[model samples]
Target: MDLYIFCRMVLQQKALILLVTVVVAALASAYAFLVRPEYQVSSVLRPAAINELDALNRSEIYQLPSGDALIKVGASLESYETRLGFFRANQKLFKNFERPGRTLEQSFEEFNYNSIKLVVPDAKNAGSLNAYIKLVMNYPEGVAGVAILNGFVQYAIESQRQQIAADMEVIVRNRLSELAGRLDSARSSYVTDKAAKIAKLTEEDNLKRAQLQDELKALRAQLKNQRADQIAQLNEAIGIAKSLGIQKPSTPSSLGGAGVQGSQPVMRTEVNNQQIPLYFMGVDALLAERAALLQRKSDDFTEARIAQIAKELQLLQANREVEVLNQRKNEDLFLSGVQPLRAEEVRLRNLNVDMSGLKLVTIDKKAIDPLGPVKPKKMLLIIIGIVFGLMLGLVAAFVRGTDQSRRENSSDTTLLPHSSIPAKKALLSNVEAL
Candidate 1:
């Protein structure tokens, strides 16, 4: 175990050490040159600007903030489903992962799980205002990493935009349908109210007409009775005038009782009164009044109130309120609440949020061609190979040295008993040759 002796022993096996080092170094170099290297390609994404989302935010129906858009894009980037979909769509870009035993599905799974990565700010710096997402892909040779990154980003954004559009469409349709339903309900209510008003007017008119007719009949009956009484009183006066032999309408003072057969002499006196009695009027005038009263057809014309009641009944035959309601050209004008709802519906229907060029997230940095592969550091590998070869060569040299020393000792021990000077000299010579 002396350092000088071990050095000599190692030098004795210098050819073996040289052969082992050269072989190991050559194998490392071959492997380094032959294995495919993976290159790193990445893109950075940031939240969109306010101006970019202005069109979508202008309407009250829906609102989307820039931060939310960034979150959605980031989530899409991190989704396994999204990566798998991208892999399936761009299989040609990932054909290099395919091998004899691996099916396309397995290769895609490997690529999706291992190759693609989303780099986000750590929890400590996650809440920073400058939050971003970095999409990284380590691709093998023959694959277009930059193209895949760019295409996947575009695809994700487009997918999110389409989803937003579809959601807006559903919202508009539902709102419009709800508005339409309200309009229908309002129309029905308006119609029902109108019909009820008409019915009410009709009932009032009928009742008024019936009351007017009853009043007219009562007035006519009263007038007819008065006429009959007047005629009966006139006949009685005529009889009395015949008995007294009065032949003309005359004042009571003008009447003289110059009758024969036990009649007393009459005394005349003047009396002033506004009305004269029917009996006091002469037989000829009374008879004429009675004849006229008996020949009368209707008593309605005699009373002024009867004429007024008839006119009212004629007017009530047609309800002017009902006529106006039925003749209305624009019934919607009356529904004050409905018009505002209609206006709102029209505004909503006219709303247009154009998302043709909608950009959800800003691409701070797009993927570009890498200058070189990130893995398989050639110089590092060569250095490691050289170190490993030197260590193995030392181990082999130590083993050979130990075995040669043990054999020299054993041969000396076994040959010493019968050894001559010549044998001893020969053994010494053999040891020197070794």
Candidate 2:
């Protein structure tokens, strides 16, 4: 009830309190010194750019590169199978460092699945590569813990490297093959287009040349007509000279001069009266005939005029021939179609064959030994044990005190029956207070 009374009661049961305190203290000390200490060795391993164009290399046309791949690496390192296999692979080391009361396989399994922890640090920034992979290994031995964590990290990195390389090689090879196929097919089509264009242009040229030939023939016929006229005029002039009793001219050889049109007039009589006038036809017949003679004229062009016409005709024929030749040459130069474009497309496709790259990349942080054990804080446990021992000892003392008080009251009731009521009431109050 009061401090002094409680102290007096505890003093009466000092032996029991002291025994409980000693037992609790001894148990605490045993636990502090005997249990094996546990250490937590932690390390970080984040994915780093493996190449200069790591982002470009890993990216595809429509896909986002996954930082989750790095997370997978971290997770695989803490898997039960991986840890168990690692322990089994190094049996002697595992036996030496593994925790007690479990087989090596079981011990490593628990260590990986239960004790080891994974953390994605800075997870709020998961949209990018802001997250870091944190791996923690909890074990009884600090050096072994660090070694095991490092080993797992190496395995994970290698696995990621292999996976990335294989995948990228497949993609690149497929893309390269596709490019080659397209370029080859395009080039073949280009060749075919070129041949077709050449054929078309040649056909058009041949047709044009044929038309030119026809034009030349017609122009030549026009030139021939002019020549024939010139020849005929030369013959007519020679015949006229012969009729005048002049010596025959030398045989005509060239038709270089112009053409002449000749019109001859014949004699005709016009009767004026029934009697012929003596003055008109009498012995002065010569004079009368002269008066009656009709003026005979020929309708003929001058040589100069014929020559001018011939030259103009010749000029027109030459101009037509020249124009036809020019048209054929111009139309045959190039095809206005798909061949040129196909050739250019082939060139562009060929240019894409040169770009290539490597695929997998990795970087890691090494695991380091922990500064001290993580568990079994000896100084802290000793302090806790002191407080625990005091409380337990006080509880034992109170229980002993209550039992002793009840025994004393029972003995008083038996020895003095008349004062039992008052004594029992006082006893009840004392028990209540206790």
Q: Which candidate should be chosen as best, given TM-score against the real structure?
A: 1
Any runs in candidate 2 off by more than 4 Å, and if so which?
A: 45-109, 120-133, 141-143, 205-365, 417-428, 431-434
TM-score of each: 0.85, 0.55
Give the least accurate 10-residue stretch of model 1, judged by summed lDDT: 254-263
Q: What's the lDDT for residue 242 in model 1?
A: 76
lDDT of 1 by residue, 1-434 (tens): 36888799789988878878887887888888889988999999998889998878887777889988988888888777777787788888777878889887898888887787888887686764758989999988888889988999988888788778888888888989998999888888999999998998898888889888898888888998988887788889889877866677777656543333465665667777767666677778778887888898888778999989978988987788888999999887787487778888898888774566889999999999999998788888888888888778888987898788868765775767554767777776665555
Candidate-wise lDDT, in order: 0.83, 0.58
Task: Kindly list the per-residue Cα lDDT of model 2 for residues 346-405, writing each as its tens digit.
Answer: 543443222233222244566777788878988888778877888898998988787888
Return the clash pairs for model 1, or none. Answer: 249-282
Instruction: Write out the backbone clash pairs for model 2.
Output: none
Clash counts per candidate, in order, are 1, 0
Alpha carbon lDDT of residue 386, candidate 2? Answer: 74
